[model samples]
Target: MSAGAAAIRVVVVDDHPTFRIGMSALLAATPGLEVVGQAASRAEAVGVVLGADPDVVIMDLDLGDGSGVDATRELLARRPEVAVLVVTMLDDEHAVYDAIRAGARGYVLKEAQPQEVERSIRSVAGGGLVLGAGVARRAMEGLAARADARPFPQLTDREREVLALLAQGLDNAAIARSLFVTTKTVRNYVYAIFTKLEVKDRAALVVLAREAGFGGDER
Candidate 1:
């Protein structure tokens, strides 16, 4: 990021000509932001970003050729130092998480304000994570939904037993005594149960487990 009197280099990748032009103009008008290239497809985006060696890339999620997620993965795999800021019409939680999982540092909807886009670019270039308005909250909600979406399909018999104990309002120490195991072993089982259930905390696990009828006397 240390450029002596040089603006941050940026590349814009979107299928629409109007959006590309508009974004380029916005970047040009902003201080310390420079639009170095524009591309219409994922392949072209990869080529342009690679050739330009831009500090930041504004990537659209859907290109005629391929997905921006794949392009972002490819770009980072080739050059780990490059920062990718995803800009797309799609603002769904899954899309945002996909971009982040593919190594994008920022996610912004196409409808984002010019100032927000510029701020996202700057944030990514400065090695910070950024999410468009409501994107982060939506992503967390999606995760929470996933936690309760299904029964504990990934749990083994022992893990399910641990989950049942957890749902029965037993703490780790109490569950250890009931299961005739060490507290450390109970803790490990609790951790595994949480992972298998895809819940973030014991409270979430209890809710999901109760819904799944895990607190019954079947065990």
Candidate 2:
């Protein structure tokens, strides 16, 4: 930002032409930032970043030609020093985590204020990580939830409950009565639980559930 100091060069990669152009214009107008290149697909992104050698790359998750996550991974593999900041409409936990795993330095929704986007670009360019407020909260909550995860994490809550009841030596009719559900519904849940856990029958399921400490409560 200061005199004689070089501005941070940046590249914008998005599938939408309007967004890419708008973002480029915004960065070009901002002090201490320079718009070096623009790309609209995975292949183009790699080529542009390599050619421009930007300090930061603004990436979108949905690239019509290919995925931005894959592009980020390929770009970082070739240019490890370049930081990638994902700016897109996707705010789901899966999308956020996938981008992080793909070596993105920051993730912010497209709805983020222009000022916020500018700050994120500066942060990542300086080797700092950034996330939008909502993204950060969801990421942290997901991590915390994983830290204390329960057994059979793949099972739904109701399925786990059925498994637990089965471990307590309850038959389908008993489980149906206990859960206030019809016998057919209980049977369906039991079938699903068996399929998910990959147990051949009730005996194996009960053994596995008991070992995992699921059936300790008195009936």
TM-score of each: 0.71, 0.70
- lDDT for each residue of candidate 2 in 1-219, tens digit (9 for 90 to 100): 679999999999998999999999999999999999999999999999999999999999999998999999999999999999999998888899999999999999998999999999999999999999989988888887885587888888888788889999999999999899999999999999889889898898999999988987623
Report clashes for each candidate as comma-separated counts.
Answer: 0, 0
lDDT by residue (tens digit), candidate 1, 88-158: 88878889888999999999888788889888998999899999886777788888888766466567778
For this target, which candidate reaches the highest lDDT against the unseen true structure? 2
- lDDT agreement with native, every candidate: 0.87, 0.92
Model 1 ranges off by over 4 Å: 1-4, 150-163, 166-219
Badly placed stretches (over 4 Å) of model 2 are 144-149, 152-219
* Per-model C-alpha RMSD: 8.8, 9.8
Candidate 2, residue 77: Cα displacement in angstroms equals 0.9
lDDT (C-alpha) at residue 45 in model 2: 93
